[model samples]
Target: MFFVTVDEKVKDAGPDDLIMEIPKLGTKIVCPTYFLVLPYEDFDYQDEDEDYLPERKYSVAIVLNFWKHTVRKMKDNETRYLPLLFHEVGMGCFKVIKEKNELRMAFGFTDDFAGDGLNIDRDSLEDFSKSVQSIDVLTMSACSPRIFQVTRKSDNPDEPVVSFNISIDECIQDVNNSRNKLR
Candidate 1:
C-alpha cells in the first residue's frame, strides 16, 4: 500500500513537491510515486507444472515521476493526458519472500537505454534489505531510459531476463534526502 502526503504550505505544488510515505517505514519519498499490483494468476501462461508457477501471490511495481511536460495535446475538444503527463525518472519491483523472511526490492531504470547502469554490492543490498524487512515492504527503482531485448549466455540461452541501470544505493540516498527535507 502507498501513502501520499501533500504539503499544504506549498501553493500550487507540483508533483515533486508531494511526498510519498510508506506506512511503518518512516522514510519520506519526495518523488511522485505510483504503485501497480499484479496477481500471478492474472498471467495467461499455460504451463502445466505447478512448480513453475511463481511463489508470490502478487508483484508490486513502483513508478516515480520527476518532471512534467509543458506541452499538452488536444484532440477534438478532448485533452489526452497520458505518457505526456509526467517524466518517469525511475521504476522498480517489490516482492515479499516469506521463506527467507526478507523483503526483496530490485530497482533499475525505466528502460535499459541512456545512462550507464549502477552496480550494487552485496553489503549494500543486505543493509537495505534488512532495513525494509522490519515493515515487510519491498521497494525498487531505476534511473535509466528505454527498454530493449538482449540475449544471455546462461543455462537457458533462449530465455530473456530484464536488467536495469540504477543502483539501490542511489535510491536509498534519495529517500534519505527526502526524509530530511520532511523533518
Candidate 2:
C-alpha cells in the first residue's frame, strides 16, 4: 500500500492532471480517472430543499475508479474512512484538515479507511477490484464524456478557474516522470 500527500503549495489541478501525477510511473488510468469529492467548506452547494444542510465541512478525496464504484454501492456520503486502492498504481485518501491558520491537504492510503463515522468492510476491497476491471474505456467515456471540463463560474466573472489544455497521454507522461511528487 502507498500514501500520497498534497499541500497548498500544489497548483490547481484538473482530473487528468491529478490522476497521471499521483499513481505508479508506468500505469495508466484504464478505468475512471477522477473522483472529485467536494466537501462543504471549500465549496458552497444548495440542494433542492433549502431547509436541509449537510453538516460535514469541506473535504475531498480522489481515489481509483474501483474505489469509486465500491463507494457508490455503499450509498453513504461520509468520506473520512474510505481507503482508495489501485492495483496497478498505489493507494491513498484525500483529506483536507485545518492547521491553525491554514487548511492542510494530503492524499495517501493506510491499513483501513478508519474513521468515527462508518465501518468499512475489508473484504469488499477485493470484490471492488474485480468488479471495476470489467469496465471498459468506452463505458467510462460514456459515463464522463468530458472528464475535466473547467469553466468560469457565472457569479464570479472576475475570478476564473484554471484549466489545462494538456492531452491525457501528455498528462500521463508528466505523471510518470513525477511519480509521487505533485507537479
Candidate 3:
C-alpha cells in the first residue's frame, strides 16, 4: 500500500486549486481535511455616534463550502450538515474582516475540527481584500494547506467553485517556524 496526494477541485470553477480531491492513497487514517483564512474584508464604518475617531474595523469571514459545498450550511443549520464531510458546524465560507492589530486569540475551529493546518495568506492580506473580496474553496477533507475564495459560476445556485490565493504570510511563517525550530 502506497500513499498519494489528490488535489481535488472545488464545486465547479469558483473554488479551484483549493483542493477538491483526495483518493486517500493507501493505508491512510481519516480523510485529510483542510481549512483556510482567506482574504478578510475591512468594514470601516462609524456607529450611530459618529465621532471623529480612528479607523476601527471589524472582520467579515466568508467560509467556503469546500468540505462538501452546501448552500444549506450558510443559511440554516449552523451545526450538523449531512453532505458536509466532517459532521460539525460553525465558520464555513464567509467573508471575514478584522483589525490587523486586534487579532483575537480566541479560536472556533479548535472544536470538532477534524482537519489540519489553518492555512492563511502570506502576502498583503489588506490589499487582497480591498481589490478582491473573496474566492472559493472545497473544504472537502482535501483542501491543502493553502488559501482560496468562493465564487458562483452562474447566478443560479447550481454553479459555484473555489479559486486559489497565493498566501505570502503562510509561506513566511512556515519558513520562519521551521528555521527557528532547526536553530
Q: For this target, which candidate reaches the highest lDDT against the unseen true structure?
A: 2
**How high a TM-score does candidate 3 get?**
0.17
lDDT (tens digit, per residue) of candidate 3 on 27-135: 1212213222122232222223432111101010111212112221223212221111221232233232222311111101212232322223322222222233223
TM-score list, all predictions: 0.24, 0.23, 0.17
Query: What is the TM-score ranking, best to worst?
Result: 1, 2, 3
**Weakest lDDT window of 10 consecutive positions for candidate 3:** 52-61
Flag regions of model 3 displaced more than 4 Å: 1-47, 51-89, 92-156, 159-161, 165-183
Alpha-carbon RMSD to native, per candidate: 21.4, 16.8, 18.6
lDDT of 2 by residue, 103-156 (tens): 222333332322322112345544333323122211111222243222222354
TM-score: which candidate is best?
1
- Indicate the residue-level lDDT of 173 in model 1: 50
Q: Which segments of model 2 are wrong by more than 4 Å?
A: 1-17, 21-124, 138-144, 148-183
The sequence of per-residue lDDT tens digits that candidate 1 reaches over residues 1-183 is 233333444333233334444433333444321111112334333433332111211110111221011011112222111111112332232322221211233222232211322112333223322333222122222222232112223453222222222233343454445434433
Between prediction 1 and prediction 3, which has the larger TM-score? 1
Better of 1 and 3 by lDDT: 1
